[model samples]
Target: MKQCWLDIRAAEGLKSVLCQEAIHRGFDAIVADDPADLAGLPPTVSRVLLPGKELPDAFGDADLVIVDPVQHGEPGRLAARHPGVRFGAHVDVTDADSLAVACASVTRDPVTVLRFADPTNIPLEIVLAAAADAHGLIVTTVERAADAPVFLGVLEHGPDGVMLAPSAPGEAGRLKDAVERRSPDLELTELTVTAITHAGMGERACVDTCTYLARDEGILVGSRAKALVLCVSETHPLPYMPTRPFRVNAGAIMSYTLADGEHTRYLSELRAGGTVLAVGADGRSRPVVVGRVKIETRPLLSIDAVAEGGEAVNVIVQDDWHVRILGPGGAVLNSTALQPGDRILGYLPRRERHVGYPIDELCYEQ
Candidate 1:
């Protein structure tokens, strides 16, 4: 992988710097001066934009970055120093320590969250948004703010469980009380809210635009963890939109979800336990399959994907109508009822070095 850095200053300068960083690695110099500059950086490399303001210490260790403080995410200690680099919507992720402390207390084996919290512990919202969108979590925003309450994302399921953004802050307490007052499965953690929006932010251009994007990508920001949150892109693409991905109760989100184009290509191989999220303005759907769909999250098919630890690696073992994924240790992680025409996660296990099933019509680099 060619690590790089981008500097977004003036539109003209941005184009040049983005091109440079896409090709090299260096310190603060990017400045988002215009739309052209903002669009200068290459879309491939992991992006890290400077907030042009306050940044936290967590970003200090980034390998490649793009500077565009005007970006969304947040301002912190690390961002302050890396002036010009733009890592907007991708900031503010569940710190590995927090996630470890949170999830380890729950999962059977209890892996260390820190291990997953590398600078690339990816925003939980982004992952979730992608998943939810895949599962057909359609978009129909309330015309009025007072419309029937919509679940922001996370919900209190049990102890050390995922949190959904409450419509009102006090609603968290209400939800907490409801869980404590009614259910008795596990302890209740605080409600967490994901920021996933793209309504005219960046490129939407209007409310219709925002809805269009969500209809296309479920929630803009999400993660690949057991649960996915749909929230706005923290350090959004540009212009800025307020999106939010809710923290789903672990296991609350079963099946799969898809956002945008690439994730939707393959709907046939999904097992019943799959989900397909659709969060885009074209909520009704146009259904244009642009690329081939591959089920492996840990994409080993492409050298580029492998180097980036792109997707989870899973193998396809079909037994007539069913598909089973054998873990590296030779155990079935999960199975689903998804059938042809259904959208499911591209199931990939950690052990098998499988390439991927190909879609006949799409333009796949593979």
Candidate 2:
């Protein structure tokens, strides 16, 4: 599970507020320099102490310990000195080389707390790179509530957690909401294309999500409950017009969408207030709200596919140049150029669902 910690060393008065919010949002732990500041905090939250070189007597009671590499020789040596201690490295982001060394050194540790000494000048790309390098729990410190989502939403699976400082009071709840809403990476399966046929003119649904989708992002849509194909969004640049970076010209109104986990919803059922999973070619998904749904009469094409288990499915899509499905090796197969034998990437659900929830009863969709 991902962990989010709250730092209350600087703004002690906001400890109660931050701790309460952390407990409410199911945050992992709270970090403080003084043990007295941890008073009255809920037992559910792990109490972390950022102690100096000399471990205090109360250090034994801490759920986790964060040691600065500058003050304490090296993280590995410290771990060896204090055997069985849950130690994490606290590195300052301003020192790029030191930060890289700390991130590399703490890959084997259980956690690493990255402190942004200059929050105003912190580079997000550097932080993301550090996260990619670190193998353990990556806990970042945020100066404000808005900074939380920026780190949590960057990559498909962002940081393992964020550390909220008391510099921003009464903002923990908002930060928690942002982190909880960020979706994790998803899995994409490969399906063999069986046939491609013209379905004539029909009304297709074009879904526009609220998030700014990249060129590789799209949604999963299909005809059957078991096998679903990835419907690329309108982010690809065309020769005629500017790209719509927020829209996924998905498929027919009746096409099934793998929006809900272990369940599916019809494209026509999506609304402006509903949420859908925008998946990238790498199979990482993030939840995006539906801002609008456009249905228009256009020439349609039906695509038939078979899964590894011999289960067959199909999806009807608009016969346009922008409408595309992800092919094997992450290739983008435009709807207008699809052939009968093209292999495409899809999702094969392992179980049946009812009312958008997984169930044991057998279900079928044409």
TM-score, each model? Answer: 0.16, 0.58
Q: Give the Cα-based TM-score of candidate 2 against the true structure.
A: 0.58
Task: Count clashing pairs, candidate 2.
Answer: 0
C-alpha RMSD for every candidate: 25.1, 8.2
Put down candidate 2 lDDT per residue, 310-331, tens digits, no spaces.
Answer: 8887888998777888876668
lDDT of every predicted structure (CA atoms): 0.25, 0.76
What is candidate 2's CA lDDT for residue 158? 61
Model 2, which residues run further than 4 Å from truth? Answer: 1-184, 260-263
When summed lDDT is taken over every stretch of 10 residues in candidate 2, the lowest stretch is 119-128
